[model samples]
Target: MSGTELTVTLSGATAADARAVVRVLEPAFGQAKEEPPTSEDVTVHTARFEHDPADRAAEPAAGGPGHLSGAVTVTVQGAPEAVSMARESLAHAFTAQDQGSVSGDQEQEWQLLLEP
Candidate 1:
């Protein structure tokens, strides 16, 4: 992955719920490389996004609210700034509770519990 790339792993929810979270992030990070999940049975879904530096200067798009069938655990891993930006984007669109984080020399991983 690129230094400016973010990988979002969503679990503890259905595929639809995971896609809902992705929809909320699309405006902030541009389109994700993964397509929407095709099976409802899947409880985990992953999406990858490459951050555009210019996006940091622009106003974050006001994403509409998303629906979740149940609480979802979202983990965002990437460069520190990229992870922070994704956290902010998710906060704006969901009821997110911090679930701790871990950081390395060049990357950061943040986890959150999201609800409808």
Candidate 2:
């Protein structure tokens, strides 16, 4: 299977904010964790999920809140189906999460940003 990367960036973020986003994505992705070099300013998280090439409808599941001190960016690398699922999962996460905030066009990747 081919691999594609899905990146979600959160600006002015904190560790709690990163965890909140990960909590929403981990279940579906099979892997969700924050990257190292974390500081008071920024945090980077990555997720991984898989999907079948033949089965288009593969639905799987899976951020918010807190003022972003810097920004948190999440990148998920997986198949096409996985990417689609991650997007859908993120939408759900946005609603389900209290602190996670979404501004601007909610239909796109940069739509959501952690509050603080």
Candidate 3:
């Protein structure tokens, strides 16, 4: 378990930020929760964009530019802290990287921001 806070920010013309966020948050979910300082301990993810880093990334992207806004919130599933950690991992990874959110929201494309 990693008690140390890990916050990585990515920027690019593409949705690279989302990809980067999910990548770093995966381990927290994949690991066992029996150990201390595990996922539930403090592992979580926040989603946001360049322009609006306060609200959750909304509507995938809609269809435009000159606007940067996204969603970001702490997630925790039922069970142990690890479970919450896993949820956060899923939320972050599943948000922009997963096909569900990406493929489903293709009408508009937006960047992602994952904060730990």
Q: Pick the candidate with the highest TM-score.
A: 1
lDDT of 3 by residue, 34-73 (tens): 2222132233333321122123232222221122234433
> lDDT scores for all predictions?
0.84, 0.46, 0.31
Name the 10 consecutive residues with the lowest summed lDDT in model 2. 101-110
Off by over 4 Å in 3: 1-14, 31-71, 83-116
**lDDT (Cα, tens digit) per residue for candidate 2, span 39-62:** 556544433333344433356452
| lDDT for residue 109 in candidate 2, whole number 0-100 | 36
Spell out the clash pairs found in candidate 1. none
For candidate 1, the lDDT comes to 0.84
The local distance difference test score of model 2 is: 0.46
Question: What digit string (tens of lDDT, one per residue) describes model 1 on residues 1-116?
Answer: 33388899999878888788888888878788878786877768899988876655345556767789989999999988788878888888889999999999989999999997
TM-score, one value per model: 0.89, 0.48, 0.22
Best first by lDDT, ranked: 1, 2, 3
Candidates 1 and 3 compared by lDDT, better number: 1
